[model samples]
Target chain A: MNGLKVIETQDLTKVYGEEVAVDRLNININEGEVFGFLGPNGAGKTTTLLMLLGLSEPTSGKARVCGFDPTREPLQVKRLVGYLPENVGFYDDMNAVQNLLYISRLNGIPDDLAGIKIKELLKVVDLEVDPRKKVGEYSRGMRQRLGIAEVLIKDPQVVFLDEPTLGLDPDGSLQMLDLIRSLSQDKKITVFFSSHLLDQVQKISHRVGIMIKGQMVAVGRIEDLAKEKFGVGQEKYTLEEVYMKYFKEGLL
Target chain B: MKGITTICRKELADHFSSTRFILLFYLILMVSLVTAFIVGSGLRDELKDVAKPTFVFLMLFTSPGKLFSLIQFIAIFGPLLGIVLGFDAVNRERSARTLSKLVSQPIYRDSVINGKFLAGLITISIMLVSIVLIISGLGLLLIGVVPGPEEISRLFIYLVISIFYIAFWLGISILFSVGFRSVATSALAAIACWIFFSFFVAMGASVMADAISPVDQARASLNPELLIKHEQTRKIISLVSPMTLYSEATTIILDPLRKTTQSILLMGPMERLSISRFQSPLPLSESVYIVFPHLISLMAITLVCFATSYTVFMRQEVRST
Candidate 1:
């Protein structure tokens, strides 16, 4: 809660009828750090992300992004953060550059800067192919790169990546991890990424939070938490191990 | 604005690049051309028969005149084109998960729906105009005759009316697209609604009216003179169809100088019958004014349907997996 907080939630909750997808939970994200949000399927990882991004309404309590209340000033929050959903999609008829350009414009970037930004972001994602080719022709990996390019176009202070490497090959996954890492180091941007891929999350995250059954079970620096929770002799606790341990504990 | 424009350009390009547009254009063109050809040939034959010596001497020969009736067929299918163009509009985006992505952008959700509706409307307008021009061109080339001032005016009014009719279907399609998530579901719903409006509504209304009305069996069966009464009653029932409004509008447009006749007759079993008739031609200006209200109503319905879609779209959550 004290380390250059970029996101803060106070008993943030989301309920659909009688089902509480996200319980009264609280978490804090710091600037210039890669935060990994790890959770099992249907464990409210996405629900939390949606609430943080102002995409979903919290049934009660409050959530803020970049110090602006997500629920009340979504546009202001959105301006400071870029969000990439798990299954990122765009107008398939538009190519990578076109898609990025459109998003840049929507974010109110100046028209003159949009073109340059689109090209730089595309290049950063290593998608330097024909900008005119329709995205429908792109392979899944290419589309993933294009999605990353879109998220980076506005150069926001914070970026949210939801399962960014879900469908990529090993090489593509590695590349995506490298890109996320570089954002924090080179651009001074905060990276809040959610993933079920434990190994990848372990490789890139500075701090990690493990969520289970709509609650955050563990939160700390990756190595410190792994050592403190699992002990020194225990084989290095993969994020998945952390998840399984907490899930079994919650079940018991 | 840039984001919406980008989306619209991409959507328009998809429409043009797809086989759907090509197939629709060809289908409409072929139907219009064939109908025009048949009507032109039929009119030529009828005119020749009317001018024949045998018919000239008889003094009762009447000319059917140009068989402009084919235009009615064209008008009837105009709305189908609109339905075809719009039925898949939003449903396709939902199925493909594109709508979610589009909404994720900072642009207002209404823009996505608005851009799509605008693109579909523009595409349909282009197709309709192209078909009309082709048919008119063929008419000129084949008959070596251009439409006179009156005929041109009538054709213009007919096109305007047809455009309004198409707008009604476009509105219905947008409503269906917003209401249904699955492409098949939207398409089926739209087509079902179209069928109901085009056929079942009129049939159902007439059947219900007949069922509720008291029948006079004694007068109906015993009196020969009552057959005409029954025929007139049936015509009145058929006028309940929307198609009847379209036909009435078409009639007024095509026959601006035609007169309407009113007649009253009295009949009794043991008495002679007396009849009175009145006829007066309606001015072109008056004919235009008469159809204006119906045209406005159809257009208003279209706008209302589109507005409903826009509202639903703005409230929709994007959660494609």
Candidate 2:
């Protein structure tokens, strides 16, 4: 409650026929904070991100981003929120600048403004050196960096990263973490990302939410979560240990 | 709505720059120009003996030798161009993992499909218009005959009809792209549909027409009553294939000799009037009215296919995988 709520969900649910992909998830993320969403594979992490972005509709319940209901005012929510999907893709035929320009246009940025913003973003993500290179020739790490630039193209208030560092070298991962950190501290933008990389999440995230089997089991600061799960005087376990404990408990 | 234009602009750039589009564009342009050249050469010889107003205009599209006319080539290959542009329109984005990124933008879900569909149609229009201009230019150079006002009006109608025809195929291709997950699967489905409508439907309709009303061998010629029944069956069956509607409309527009509402007249019980009896060419307005139903049917089929794609796309869920 210290900061204004940028993202809120109440009993948000998504079911696919007999399978419940996301079930009655309730969570709130404050503004200008790096919120790490941690879960194992098929834990409904991506599903939740999609629902919040208004890319996929929830079966029932309500969710809001930037004070707009995602289902009712999806376009409004999407305008203020940027989402970088896992395994980000670009039109291979287009150069780096062209790809970013294309995205900027989709977000309703004019040509002159888009050009200036794209150059700035490319510089921000360190892709300005070879802005004219076709994306087909880009490496995994370069593409991930470009993906970050794409999310920032519209100057969104809130950004979602679904496993942004899923496939990258150690160097690439570190660079990505630096970029995410700068997004919160320098740009004052809300960052919500899901990842299985506990070490990376622990380093950058101020607060983390752990989900398992379509439900949020834990949400708080790492220190507070550790104190609550293990006794206050007990050994200080890392996010990896804390995440595994909730995931295993959810199995039962 | 601005999202539609943005997506369309991007899609157009992609289509215009891609090697696949370039190859198809050149192939279509080269083949069409070559066809026009051959027709122009033949018309040069015919124009010397007799001067026919309609013949001069029609000769550009009509065949000179045994080769198929320019219109026939378009009627056959237009769907291929449409399928090429649209088969991977949506699925490629999905497979490339760009669909989620594009949809996650501030645009409505319908915009993506609309933009892609609109882009394909625009590309089709560009191709068709260029070919027309090139042929007309070549005709003026080779045969020294400029189309009259009537010819220009007819040609414009023909162009509009061609757009609708290709748009119908584009719709079908996009529909497959929206329905299927894999790019290859959607492409295969679109090609299968093209073949079914292009060739198989005609053959099937013929068989069904023959079965529906059998022709007696006792008479050398088809009687008025039996011809009417067969024609009715054929019309009803051909309505299922968009190609039929397109070809029918184009023939009426281009030839001006054929009419849509043709009925057999039997002066006596044993004697039936021939098609030559009604061989007088109608004016442009009358021809349009005659082929009005075919035009409407073509538009209806295209709209239905587009509506299906729009619905499926809006309902489709985006997965990060």
Candidate 3:
């Protein structure tokens, strides 16, 4: 429960009145691994991410992020875990540096250190082009990149990106994918991302978990899941085919 | 604690930088300066009738004219400043989608509310202090009056009371911000409450007093008991309004000749110490005790509003935004 795994959940569940948002979720994400949490809309992907970040409490059971219970030691968990919500927002009047400085302060990073870290992360995310410009003036792609820099402000051990490539063009998504890839490869940070795009998940995630109807239906390396259940020749099939095979009947 | 400081600093920056806040502050300042000018010229005529120089300083604040005095203006308009600043404090963050990001940080959940409320209180403090300084400086420049130590202390207390009144409005406005999802609705709610307390409460108190205690005008001269009952009933009914408490406290502090009681037979210890009405201002500590309940009630209402907002903000779902 502590070593190797950066995130571990035991029967973590979230219920909103009559609707079960997350149903007895048990997930383990190891350190330094890129994990893809795949689901259709309303499939509880955001709900699970919220619980993991300690922003929302699960109806039952618990989750630990970076060896700290999110419900009990939420501050400690938050210290080591970063989250970029779907459609991340920034203060419209503030420039990129101000927004990131605010985040670094909230994380208790010293001002001088925050300045250096923010400059570095801004360059890493390629948002250093016009750091003085207001966020309201930024394009959709630029905002997402700034969101990446924001998540990396604390140099957290784990990062959660809820549809980071959402609303992006093909070129922008490709850049986002590269930035996400470098997060795990170069920084050795655990990246847990949620997306509905099959090809995007297949390109970056080391392992993928597919959730449907508030339940995780499939999890593991793509090759293993396809070879074992989808048939002999399906191992060579694209992730889109594998996704179609598993979700075709359930989707309709 | 550090999180609270960070949030507070950011909130203060936002308030000070906003055009709305700057414009409203200037409006308040302009009106206060005008009132100071009018009171200064008027006090020049009154100084001939009264030899007490201390009375001149107090007149700068309490003089009545076609326009309301500085204190009355604040009593009416100060709440708007607080409401405008705080009406969207929480809801704006939610609408802008920054609240979820703020909550997901390492800070404690209650820190958001605490920081916001603290920042608002500080802003109110700064605004009130500046208004006091401007009016007093204007009085010095125009009327050539050097306030005595007692008068300065009284003005300081009055300034504190004004701040408490505005902060009460700030608390309720923030409460709406925390409770409502829409910023417009929250602002509307705060203004509605302000109208109710500022205008309707006084009318309601008078109507309730007349209903509960019908005056016997036939025996008017011999019925001190009836008059006291009517006054007490109106006061009890209007206790819900912070303005009533503030006005009551200011009268005792600014006008030494004005006694809290209508009858001389029920004179308190402080009133007993003075042989004449206009001889001198009451001692600062003694006058504070005279209006102690009024001050406490204003503070208590502000605290209750703040506490309610704090609770609401803490229990709210971050994901609901």
Per-residue lDDT of model 2, residues A1-252, tens digit only: 258999999999999889898989999898899999988889899999988987788999999998999888889989999999888899887788888888888888899999999888888988754656789999999999999999999999999998999889999899899999999998889999999899999999999999888888999998888888898964378998888888889899
Query: Model 3 chain B — which ten-residue stretch has the worst lDDT?
Result: B258-267
- B246-309 per-residue lDDT for model 2 (tens digits): 8778878888766554444446533334454544678999999988989998898999999998
Off by over 4 Å in 1: A1-4, A67-69, A72-76, A90-116, A128-134, A223-238, B1-3, B40-70, B136-157, B214-247, B257-281
How should the candidates be ordered by DockQ, best one leading? 2, 3, 1
User: By the TM-score metric, which is better: model 1 or model 3?
Assistant: 3
Interface RMSD of each: 2.5, 0.8, 0.6
- Name the regions of candidate 2 deviating beyond 4 angstroms: B44-55, B219-224, B260-280
lDDT for each candidate structure: 0.72, 0.86, 0.88
Alpha-carbon shift of residue B292 in model 1 (angstroms): 4.0
Superior by DockQ: candidate 1 or candidate 3: 3
Cα lDDT for residue B292, model 1? 70
Among these predicted structures, which one has the highest DockQ? Answer: 2
- TM-scores for all candidates: the values are 0.81, 0.93, 0.94
- All DockQ scores: 0.38, 0.88, 0.85
Error of 3 at B305 (Å): 0.9
lDDT of candidate 3 over A143-198, digit per residue (tens): 99999998999888999999999999999999999999999998899999999888
